[model samples]
Target chain A: MTRRRLQILMPWAVTLGLFALWEAFCKISGIEVFILPAPSDAWAAGVEFWPQLLEHSLQTLFTTTAGFVLAVGFGVLLGLAIGSSTLVYKGLYPVLVGFNSIPKVALVPVLVIWFGIGTVPAIITAFVISFFPIAVNVATGLATIEPELTDVLRSLGASRREILAKIGLPRAMPYLFASLKIAITLSFVGSVISETVASNSGIGYLMLAASSNYNVPLVFAGLLVVAFLGVLMYALMALVEGRMTGWAFRGTDLMS
Target chain B: MSDPEFHPADFMKPADFMGPADFIKVDGVDMTFSRGEEEVHALRGLDLSIPKGRFVAVVGPSGCGKSTLMRLLTGLAKPSAGTVTLEGAALRGPAKGVGMAFQNASLLPWRSTLSNVMLPFEIVAPHKRRLRANRAEYEARARALLKTVGLEAFADNQPWELSGGMQQRANVARAIVHEPRLMMLDEPFGALDAFTREELWSVMQALWMERGFTAVLITHDLREAVYLADEVLVMSARPGRIVHRQEIDLPRPRTLEMTYEPPFQAHVHSLRDHIQTVREAH
Candidate 1:
C-alpha cells in the first residue's frame, strides 16, 4: 500500500487489534463482568440501553461544547491583551500558572455549592479547565512573530494596532487551533468530572450509577461513548486547522 | 557592446562633494547598547551623506554595526550623539514612507505573492485610503512589477510555493510596489547562492533604474556592493565608522559578465583590501 493509504488504515487496524486482544484475554482468564467486562458484553449492554446512552452522551456533549465556546471567546481576548502588552503578561502569567496548577477537580464542590447539582456546574468546570491552554497558546503565538517581518511593517508606518490585527492574529491562528484540540478534550474531562461529582444526567453520572448497581458492562459503554466523542471533537478541530492555517504547514505531510 | 548612449565621461568623474544634493545626512553619530550590564558601542563618530536618487552600499565585517547604521538612516533608531537627517529635518521616530527588504524574504506565508506585493498599500497612507476604490489600478501595477521580476506567473501562488530566488524576487517587488522615496536593504541577497545572487543583481539594477529611488544597502559582499551601488562605504570593526569610501562610476544596467571583467574585479579587490585592513585594525 501507498504511505498515504497506510497512514489512513494504520490507526483503525491498531484499535481493532487491541480490541481483539482484549476479548481474547477476557475469554481465557474467565474474568467476571464486574471485575472486567469484555468488549462483547459492553457492546451488548450498549445496544440494550441505547436510548439512555444516547441521552446521557448528548448531555455530556452539550455541556462540553457550551463551556468550550465560552472559553474560546474569553480566552482569546485575554490572550490578545497578555500577548500584546508586557504589563498584562507579567501581571497575569504567574497568577494564571498558579490557577492552572490547582487541580480543577478540587473546585467541583465549590462550584456545586454555588450552582447546585446539574448542567450549570459541569459547564462552568469545563470552561475554567479549557480556557488556560487556549489563552497561553494564543499569547505565545503573538509574542513570537518574526522580528524581520515586524521591521517590514514598522518601516511602512503600520500602527501597533494594525500590526496586531494584520499579522499577529493570523499568525496566531494555527497556534489557537492546535490548542483547541487539547482544550476540547480537557473540556470533556472537566464536564464529566463535574457530572460524576454531582449531576442528574450525562455519561459520567450514568457510569457512576452503573458501577453502584454492578452493571460493569453499562459503565464500559459510557466510557466508550465519551472516548468516541473526544476523538470526534479532536478530528473536527484538526479539519478546521487544516482549512484555516494550511499555509503554516506548507511542505508538511500534516496538510495532506 | 557599449551603446552610443553609454557616457564614459560620466563614469570617469568620482563623487567627492557632500552638500546641497545630499538627501540623507548622518553627522558624528554614535550608537551604544547596554547588553546585560556592559555598554557595547556599535558605532561611534560616524559621518556620511547620500545624494538624492543615489544607490549607496555599506560593507563591513560581521559585528561592525552596519545594521545599526541602516537603522539610524531608516529612523528606526536614534543616535546616542549627533544627528541623522533626511532632506534637512532631523528624524525623531520611524521615518515615513520607507521601503525595506531583508536577507530573509520575509513574505507573509498566509498571503499569496500578489497579495504580499500589495501589502504596503494596506499600510501606507493616502494609498491605504484609496486602495479599496482603486484596487484594480494598484493590482495592475503590482502585476507589472512581478512581470519585471519574472514572477508574474506565480503571483497567485502562496509565498512558500516559490523557490528561494523567486521568493526574493517577490520580496524586492513588495519593497518597491509602494513607490517610496527612500529604500533600505539589509543584506537583501545575502542568503542566496552565488548564481541566484548574481541573477538578482541585474533584476535589482533594472528596478532601481526604473524607480530612481534613494537606496541604502547593507551587505558584506563587496561584489554585490560594487555591482549595485553608485558608491560603496566600508565600516571599521566594533565602534564602527566609515573607514573607506569607493565610488563605483560604472555605466548603467551593468551585466553579469561585466562582474568578471577587470574594471569590476578591480573595484571588488580594492574593497576586499580595505575590509582586510579594517579587520586587522580590530
Candidate 2:
C-alpha cells in the first residue's frame, strides 16, 4: 500500500484491536448477559433478529431521508433568497436565529400531538433539526464572493440574474454540500429521538423495547444499527459532495 | 533651433477630439466619499473624454483616487456631482459596454478556468438571452480565448491549480471574452512577479492592438503606464485630481527594447519627478 493509504488505515486497525480486547475481557470476566453482553452475544442477537432489525432500520432510513431532502430544498432556497438581498438579510436574520435557537427536541411533544405517534412526527423532527445548518452555510457561501470577481462580472455588463446563476449558485454549492453532510447526520439523530419518544416502529422504538425487557444484547444490536445507518447516510452525502466539488479539489490537499 | 509657437492641432485635449455625438464621455465629473463623520473628496471636477477606440492609462499613488475614477467610469458608484455619459446618454448604472479586471485575478474556486471565462456570456446578453440556444458556440469562444492565453491545455483546471501569473492571464481573458467596447483594468498585473508581469503585459498589449478596444488602465507602475498607454494621465494625492497629462511619442508595435532606450528612460524619469513633486507637495 502507498504510505498515505497505510497512515489512514492504521487508525481503523487500532479501533478494531480495541474492540477485540473488550470482547475478550467480557468473555473472561463471565459478565451477566443482562448487565453487559459480550460482543459475540450482541452479534448473535443481531443475526437472530435480522429480519425485524432490517425493517426497523429501513423505517428510520426512510424518515431521515425524507426529512433531509425537504430540509435541503427549503433551506437552500430560503438561504439564496435572503443572501442575495441585503435588505432581506437585515430584516430576516434575527428571526431565523431566534427560530433556530428553540431546541428542536422541545417541539417533539407538540409534533407528536399534531401529527401523531408515527413517521410524520419523526420526519418533522428530522426536518426541524437539519434545516438550520443548510440555511446558515448556504447564506454564508452566497454572500462571501470575492470583490474582484464581482467587479469583473459588473464590468462585463453582466446582468443581476447572470451573477446569481453563474457566480452565486456555483460558488455556493460547496457550502451547501458541507451543510448537507452535517444536516444528514442531524436528520438521522432527529428521526431516532422522535421514534424513541413517540413512535411505534424503527430502530429507536426497538431500542426502547429491548431496554425495558432487560434485553441488553438486543439493545446493543439496535445501537449498532443506528450507528451503521448514520455512517451510511454520511457516506452518501460525502459521495455527492465529492462528485459536485471535483473541480474545487484539483490542486488542494483534499484531492488525495 | 527651437520652433516657437508651433503646436499640432491634433495635440488638443481628449475632449476636443470627440464630435458632438460620440460613444462615451466623462464630462466635468466630481466624486466625494464620506467615511463616518469625515468627508474625503476623491475626484475634483475631472474632465476626460474617451473617443471610441483609444487606450488610456491613469497612473497615480495609492490614495490618488485612480480606483475611484474606475468605479465611477464603470457606474459602480455615482459621482457626488457632475456627469458620466455613454453615447450622449447619462449613466445611472453600470453601462453594457464596459468590462473590468483587477490586481487580483479572483477566479471562483468552484469553477474550472473554462467556466470562469465563459461566465460573462452566461450572465449578460445579448449573450445571456441566447446562451442556451448557442451553448456550443459560446463554449468554442471560451476555448478560443483560453487558447489565446496559452491556457487551453488547462481549461479543466480550477483557479488554484494555476500559478498567480497564469490566473491573471485567465482574468484578462475573462474580462475581454464578452467583447466589451470599453475595458477597465485596475492594476491587473500588480500581484505577478517581474518576468510574468512583463509577459502578461505583452499579452495584454497584443490583445488591445488586435482587438482595437478602448481601454482605461489604472496603475501605479510608471513603466507599465508608458509602455501600454497612448496617453498617460497622472493624478495628485488625497483629494485627487489630474495634475499632468503626457502624450507618448513612441512608435506603435512597441517592444521591451524601446523601454530600455534614452527616450523611454527620459519619460520614466520625468514621470517619477512629477510624482515625487506631487508627493512632497501633499
Candidate 3:
C-alpha cells in the first residue's frame, strides 16, 4: 500500500485488531460476563440499545456544546483582562491555578446540590472545568508578543486599543484554538462526571444505570459511544483550528 | 589627517561642525534606566545634530547605548535631562511621520507581504482616515514600494513562505510605505548573511535617494556604516556619548564594487580603529 493510504488505514486496523484480541481472550478464558463482556457482546448491546444510546449521546453533546460556548466567551474576556493588565494577571493567576488544581469531579456533587441534579449542573461543571485552559492559553499568547513587533507598531503611533485589535487578539487566536481542542475533550470529561453523579440523561448516566443491573456489555457500549464522541469532537476542533490559524502551523509545511 | 587618532576631548562638542538648521538634534541627553534594583546609566551627556536629508550612522561597541540614541532621535523615550528636537520642535513623545525598521523583520506572520506593507496606513493618520476611501491608491503605493525592494512578486506570500532575505525586503517595504520624512533603522541588516546584507545596502540606498528622508542607522558593522552613511558617529563606552565623527566624502550612487575599492576600506579601517580605541578606553 502507498504511504498515504497506509497512514489513513493504520488507526482502523489497530483498533479492530485490539477488539479481535479481546474477543479471543474472553472466548478462551470463559470470563464471567459481569466482570468483562466480549467485544461481540458489547457490539450486540450497542445494536439493541441504539435509540436509547443515541438519545443519551445527543444529551451529552448538547450539554458539552452549551458549556463550551460559555467557556469560549468568558475565557476570552478573562484572558483579555488578565493579559492586558499586570495587576489582574498577578491577582487572578493564583486563584485560577488553585481552582484548576482541585479535581473537577469533586465539584460535580456541589453543582448537583446547588442546581438540583440535572443538565444545568452538567453544563456548569463542563464550563468550570474546561475554561481554565482557554483562559491561560489566551493570556500567555497576549503576554508573549515579541517586543520588537510592539516597538514597530508603537513607533507608528499605534494606540493600545489599536495594538490589541491588530496584533494581540489575532496573535492569541492560535493559542485559543489550541486550547479549544484540549478544552473540548475536558468538557466531555466534565459533563460525563456530572451526569454519572447527578443527571438522568447522557452516556455517563446510561452507563451508571446499566452497571447497577450488572449489564456489563451495555456499560461497555456506552463507554465506546462516549469515546467515539470525544474523538469526533476533537477532530472537529482540529478542523476549525486549521481553518482559523493556519499561519501558526505554516512552519510545518502543512499549508500553502 | 592620514592617521586619525581617536580622542574623546577633540570630538566632545562635534555639534560646532553641524549645520545651523538641524533636522534632528539630541542636546546634552542623559538616559539612565532602572533594571530591578540597579540603575543602568545608558547614555550620558550625549550631543548629536543631523542636517536635513542626510544619512547618518552610529557605530559603537556593544552596550554603548547606540540603541538609546536611536530611541531619543525617534522620540520613543525622553532623555532624563536633555531635550530631543525634531525639525526645531522638542519631541514630547514618539515623533510623528517617522518610519522604523528593526534587526528582525518582525512582520506579522498572518499578514501577506502586501497587507504587512499597508500596516502603517491602519495606524498612521491622516492615512488611517483616508485608507478606506483611497484603498486602491494606498495599495498601489505599497505595491510600488514592494517593487522597489524587489518583493513585488511575493506581495501575496506570507512572511514564513519567504526566505529571511525576502522577509527583510518586505520589512523595508513596510517601513517606507507610509512615506515618513524620518527613517530610523535599528541594525536592520544585522541578521542577514554578508551577501544578502550587501544586496540590501543597495536597496536601502536607492530608497533613501528616491525619498530623501533623513535617515539614522544604528550598526556595529564598520563597513556597513561607512558604505551607507554620509557621516558615521562613534560612541564611547557606558555612560555613553558620541566620541568621534567621520564624514564619508565618497561620491553618491555607491555600489557593492565601490565597497571593494581602497577609499571604502580606508574608511572602514579608521572606524574600526575608533571602536577598538573606544572599547579599550573603558
Higher-scoring candidate on DockQ, 1 or 2: 1
Ten contiguous residues with the weakest lDDT in model 1 chain B: B1-10
Q: Which ten residues in a row have the lowest lDDT in candidate 3 chain A?
A: A247-256
List the global CA lDDT of all models. 0.91, 0.84, 0.89
In order of DockQ, best first, we have: 1, 3, 2
Which has the greatest DockQ?
Answer: 1
| Candidate 1, superposed: residue stretches over 4 Å from native | B1-20
lDDT of 2 by residue, A161-237 (tens): 76788788988888999999999999988999999999999999999998999989999999888887888788788
Task: Arrange candidates, best TM-score first.
Answer: 1, 3, 2
Chain A vs native chain A, TM-score per candidate? 0.98, 0.92, 0.95
lDDT of 3 at A147: 79
Query: Candidate 2 docking category?
Result: medium
lDDT of 3 by residue, B190-266 (tens): 99999999999999999999999899999989889988999999999998999999999999899889989999999
Work out the iRMS of candidate 1: 0.8
Clashing pairs in 2: A155-B99
| Residue-by-residue lDDT tens digits, candidate 1, A151-178 | 7887788878888988999999999999
Q: How far does residue B281 in candidate 2 sit from its true spot (Å)?
A: 2.1
lDDT of 3 by residue, A86-158 (tens): 8999999899999999998899888877889989999998899899999999999999998778777877878
lDDT of 2 by residue, B1-282 (tens): 011221233223344435764655777788887889988888887877777777888987789899999988877778898887765556666666477899988888777899889878876668888999989999999999888888999999878989999899998998899888889999999988889988887888888998998899999899998999888888888778788888888888888999999988888998999899889999
What is candidate 2's fraction of native contacts? 0.80
- The true-versus-predicted C-alpha distance at residue A170 of model 1, in Å, is 1.4
